[model samples]
Target: MSIISLRSILDANKLSGNNFNDWYQNLRSVLMHEKLIDVIDKPANVAPQKGESNASALDAYAKYFEQSTTTKCIILASMSPELHRQNESMTPAHIIAHVKKMYESESRTSIHRISKSSFKIRI
Candidate 1:
């Protein structure tokens, strides 16, 4: 797919800290639809050890790494400036994990509060 197309989509759905789940879902859906999920889902396979013929694996790794980094950059471009600053040095996987941690904690805390309120009402 063209970079222009991807950029346009990201521009329209740009993320700015809040609404992370929605932003992530839309971004992921677009990426998957473009058949570029492997770039984010799979890391480059390890190189072969000494004395082993690793030509094919090396080639695959190189291609995967290139695409992965490109995809990571694209995804980063859609994030908020603060999020980008915090995660600029991170790999795509690490960035994703960080975002999930931030948002999922909010969800968990909400659930806990709701449960506590229910218990209080019963008691």
Candidate 2:
């Protein structure tokens, strides 16, 4: 995607801490579109060790690093500043897992709103 389009996508779904479900779904869509979502499932040690010169291993590391960095940037850019600060040091996979663990449950206010709306029926 063009930079403009990517910026647009991130802006639309920018995570505000409580909107985890919507933000994560949008992130997945963007990553899938860029074919980078699989990076989140790979171990962070996919990086090659120094002087470990197997051609295939090096190639794998190169691809892994590219996908990891790109996906990481996308994930970070879509986050709130607070979340970005908290997760800045983690790998893409770890960041996703951390945030998912932290925010997967809808906030009480959100759940209450949904419940309230769902029951607002009139005869």
Candidate 3:
């Protein structure tokens, strides 16, 4: 997808201190649609040195790095200026973790509000 179009999506979903869950879900959906979900899910294991029994890990890491950088670009393209500033230096994995923390905290607050309101209803 074009970076300009992706930036438009980010602009529309700008995070203004709330609505983290919706923003994150939309961002993730976009990333998935771009076929970058592997960057969020699978990280390459450390490569063994030459002469080690399991040198194949090196190849895996190479592949992972290639895909991960592409994924990072997609994510960066879809971030608002504020969110991008917060995570500009982070790796793709760390960016996802940071977003999850921000959004999950808000989700808990929403759940609490729902439960509190539910208890106030009379049968």
Which number leads on TM-score? 2
**After TM-score superposition, what is the CA distance of residue 63 in candidate 2 from its true location, in Å?**
1.1
Against the hidden reference, what TM-scores do the models get? 0.72, 0.80, 0.64
Which regions of candidate 2 fall more than 4 Å away from where they truly are? 1-7, 107-109, 120-123
Q: Give one digit per residue, the lDDT tens place, for model 2 in 1-123.
A: 634354467787789878888788788888887788788865664567888889999887888888888888989989989999999999898998899888776555688887888888531
Tell me the whole-model lDDT of each prediction, alpha carbons only: 0.75, 0.81, 0.73
Off by more than 4 A, model 3:
1-8, 45-63, 118-123
Q: Against the true structure, whose lDDT is highest?
A: 2
Q: What does the lDDT read for residue 82 in candidate 2? A: 91
Native-to-model Cα distance after best TM-score fit, residue 102 in candidate 3, in Å: 2.8
RMSD of each: 4.6, 2.9, 4.4
TM-score of 2: 0.80
Order of the predicted models by lDDT, top scorer first: 2, 1, 3
lDDT of 1 by residue, 3-112 (tens): 53555677777777556767788778777876777666776456567777778977777777786787778778888788888888987778888888887677667778
CA lDDT of 79 in candidate 3? 69
